[model samples]
Target: MPLGTIVRLLGKQSQMGYLDEVYNSVEDLSSDYFQTKACKAMLLKPLNAASSHCHRLKINIDDTKPREVYVCKDTSCYAHCAFSSVPDTLCKCGKVMEYAGDRPENDAKTAAAGSDNGVFVIGSQKFITTDDLQIGNVKIKVLQTRINSAVLYAEVGHDFVDLVFGLLSVPLGCVTKALSQRLSKGCIDNLYRSIAGSAEGCMGPDYKRMLLAPELAPFFGSGASQILEAAESAPKKIKVDSRFSCFKIGGFSNLGRCREQAYRYNSSYGCNRHEFTYCQNTTKTAEICELDPKLHGVQNSNCDAYVKQGPQSFMVTDDLHVRPLTLDSSLRVVSEGKVQMKDLVEKEVALTKLQIMELQRAALMTCEALSSVLLPPKKKKKNLKHLMY
Candidate 1:
């Protein structure tokens, strides 16, 4: 008998029940029966199985040969999407197709390392991995210079009360009181050296006696000793006017002569009195010193006439003026001070916005690629098989 004729006879005689029972019994008797039974037990199990296996039953709509039904296992239906063509067999409803191969996984480890290694480019600015530090050694040196300058200023402002009295023509006690309130410790130390040096020329015996005193002994070393020796070697005093007495009494002939010598000492030895003002108001003292003594003829003509103001003080100016610089002109303004390493790092990090954005973009692209690979494919209906039994 023909296979079709036999199948028809069996279908009609048992109403397809006998064929289904026989198929089920054979499936149960197999070693993989539990898997097969569980699959067949669901109302939608056959549809899922048919879809996954690319099985589809199609009735030939065309007038083709008898027993020529087509069972298509492979079809390409998702050929027009942006990503790639998808196989129809991947979907439950095989009419719907999808790109159903194992997707490429993103290399997250590579991306993170790349982000760390990537050059940060912003507008015309580009910094590489080697230059990623917030505060480098160069900036640290600049900060150190600033701190040293401050400390020097403090020492000069804190000592040498007698020098202030001699220069300002005030009483020694009054000068000491003013220095206590006005000068920083740095400023006073500087003043003591100046007074000691000047005293050696006219008051050499008195200056040496003071240096030997235990209380003032610490200031007599290295740089201070050289200044004292120079003063001690100079010629004795010639009496000048009482107004010019501070310079003459200290054994220098005049305030102008003392200042000239002081300027030479500062320029050669790095003893920068003019550059080391304790406060903004005291900067005027430097300006006054720089004027032509022959022309301006010294008003408060003592070498140390100017008061040293401490760190927190500033000179108040009545006028609000803005001075514009000429092209290529340089302004010689001193820096305010230094910042600590912690503060420096915080500022640098705050300024690295462009770098942070580049890293984030790289991370997002990496994640997007990875997500496409791990996610499962979508479902469709064309892969279903209609079991008439």
Candidate 2:
């Protein structure tokens, strides 16, 4: 019997005697996921199996292959997509992520290493905390924090905060995990755009202008205006070319990388999760090889290409407002004062040492002069001795 038929039958009657016998007859079928009590409960309200971050399922329209569509769970991804295989990857919220089903036999081992949304546990204790969420050595910035208060906030990139995502006074780790779950469901991009778009036509310059200025147009393209135009004109796709600037490929050197545009380069391995192309042969210069007219280049081939890469990884914007403590301009003043004081002390010590050395040399010269002046009668005694002989 079909699963749909069983569901329909289950809806008519709460309990069925033969259902258990039928389930027993089926091979490799477990009662854990299909308990009678669970089925009745699910009939009232559907269950969301995708809630877990370790495993996700992808369904297809056609039925040509087996029904194993399990993929990597990505709760914080911007597009709400899943990965086929686990690699060095991140969710849209900038959390270092791990997939559970990547290694089924050693699932416990994988959990010990890392978990979805950059969370993990060691022994019985969990590492999730509000003080700071770190991926490797890079500190994941907390946008806002309140001790002994119910309200807490976390920075999920693009200068946006995860407000109202956690309990008022819970440990920071719980808050981070809650925010990570929200981010995985495509909220990061939405919140980012909502906040960014609200700044348009404001009184002063916006965030994009502050980080990427007009002088950087040659390498990046354009700033606020170009992005606004792209958003307003085309909601789905944004074109990349020499006209617009301000797109930065993270972890990739933007020097003589792109064949057509010397400054535009492909992201290094693991830098761009999906290997997206910032430039293509669709541009006029790329079609005819304007940089060097001698060589014939493929219209869409030479710009930036990757081979056998994974699915499109969700991309996040950089946060420019928050800087490290060591680079704070206010702290530089105190450091400079301390440096000046140290230099003065060093110079004073050197001067004192030089004076002591000079005094010792002068004393030696004076002693020699005194000996010569006081011992003038020695030659007369020697002459008397010679006459006596």
Candidate 3:
């Protein structure tokens, strides 16, 4: 009942010469001829309708040359190695040709081909030439998957061929399922176990016993061994007894024995020897003290009393030699000061009361003035007119 089906039926029955006439008639048919059928079906109906006239489908392959092989100049591929000619079925690096036939020598050549430099594969699907490979395409994904799989297996101590085979054996769907599985519970555990075993095999018994314990799970092998070894060899905390030596406080030797002796004797009294001098009479003395040589007296007599010239020769005071104060003196000063502060506060409260009362009165007056200015005016009732019917 559909227009395409009608056209197809007509095309099948009609003679080759009359096919075009039938096709033209179908094209002129109403747009409503078919509903819910595929547009492709309608479009192809004309092709079928005109196909009886000895027409054949022709496909053309564009005249594009294959990309030239760029042999790496690195030692990995042995580009430096001399060869008689480019091998018929293999590259100079032993990689099998793209169109190599299945032969023993070709297979052997390819198996031996790859070096540390690059990979060589036989029968790899040619999605595109190396030059034609674009950023976003299936080719890139496949290449990445292959490279990652190779690296993974290599890390686990598998040879390239074995790694490739192991990866290839895994179905893409299984890979998807593996990816979807929990990494901690499954993939990571297996990976850890494999790496641990590889390390144990390679590193010998001492490492195996110390590093690869099954109980450690994720933290097995060299990582664990390194941590344990580091911890064992780590620097220890050494307790050293540091004693404080007594510092001999004294005056400079150049200032003479009196000054040195004075500093030595009065160090306990917190006096620098050169700062004060003992005088005999009211006259100032220039005679240096026998104990403190730096102190020059105004006169040549010895005095029992000492005078300290205040800093910059300002005020003079008697030395009133006080004994060295004990640590208890510092504590008493703090305690007495606190008690004095409390007594002063108790006496000051009466004086503050009048001032506080005056402040409160000023605050109240300010608040009243502010409220009168900010408050809204009270609304008055509006009188309404009443109409009597």
Candidate 4:
């Protein structure tokens, strides 16, 4: 088991007040304790909803597109006029809206809100002070408007009650459903699709139908086909030289000594390999290579690339095996060697190669072996015994 897992298990036991009995033989530990992150996400689910309950509505007025402030034409209601682009639409008060003018200054009596740019004036005369707008089955009334720089803001009727209900009334299941709807209809997940669809066929029909040109041929235009045909008809010769390391539209060329030869090739040849790095020819420094967004995007990066393989797949299977020592065995051998070294150093002994071999044969000897190597030889004790005889 991992050390993190052991720590988490002990934490759980302490939380349950079962620390004493946690090490019992048959503790009822759930299989969840052993599960991974993906498994936990699949199993555990939230039951109660939790939210900040803060949602604001702001109306931004475009100054450049001046003559199109939207207002309802119904003379009865004065509270529902909004600055919308859609000129012809039914207002929340069921009145037809039309383009009033550049500013809503004409209806001064309905001018409830004022800003530095202009003022917000209501269009309806009959309905003043209160008008309700239905947003997701919640009929919120317009209370008053406030100036917010270039934008105008309004507080909904019963705003406190609505916030309280948003926190208490909605369950977790409903919250999940609302989140799914928000993701799908909020123009977030499908925003890229909408943008891609809008830009379809923007490069014209001929470019869309064009095929990839052969190497050493005109990549586009009328001469592309002719150039490709000539290269096929005649045995086109391709010179391979180690001098130039990069390829370009004008054939192979050297971009001098630079690590970003690929970027230089794209800039000179008008290739879309590294779009972000193109047109940035101040100084071909290493910083430009790091700034390329293609390295972090869908395009494959030559600079930083990552490849992953499973641990089992990389395990050694041949006779060239790795043998690792256990912690206890290594510690024991190190401790013994340190003791033997300390004894020899204290005796201040020096031994010849032959005496060193003899010490090894004695299997780590005492101070006697060191004294024998260090002391001078005794003057023939056996000769003294022969003279006495």
Query: Backbone clashes in each candidate structure, one number apiece?
Result: 27, 17, 14, 3
Q: Candidate 1's residue-wise lDDT over 1-389, tens digit each?
A: 11112223344232221222222222333222111121111111111101111111132121211111111123232221111111222122233222222222233543443333221111233323222221101010111122221210111111121111111111112222222332222243344444344334433343233332211111111111121221211111122222222221222122243233322246667775543322222211110011111111112223211122232221110010111222221112112223343332111112122222221121112322111211233345564465443
Model 3: lDDT equals 0.22
- Model 1 segments beyond 4 Å from truth? 1-210, 213-296, 301-389
Best by lDDT: 4
What lDDT would each prediction earn against the true structure? 0.21, 0.22, 0.22, 0.23
| lDDT (Cα, tens digit) per residue for candidate 3, span 66-156 | 1111122222443221111011222334443232111112234323333222121112223332332221000000001111111000011
**Candidate 2 runs further than 4 Å off:** 1-108, 111-119, 126-389
The TM-scores, one per candidate, come to 0.12, 0.12, 0.12, 0.12
Q: How well does candidate 1 match the true structure in TM-score terms?
A: 0.12
Candidate 2: global Cα-lDDT? 0.22
Q: CA shift at 266, candidate 2, in angstroms? A: 63
Q: Per-residue lDDT for 292 in model 3?
A: 14
> How should the candidates be ordered by lDDT, best one leading?
4, 2, 3, 1
**Weakest 10 consecutive residues, lDDT, candidate 4?**
48-57
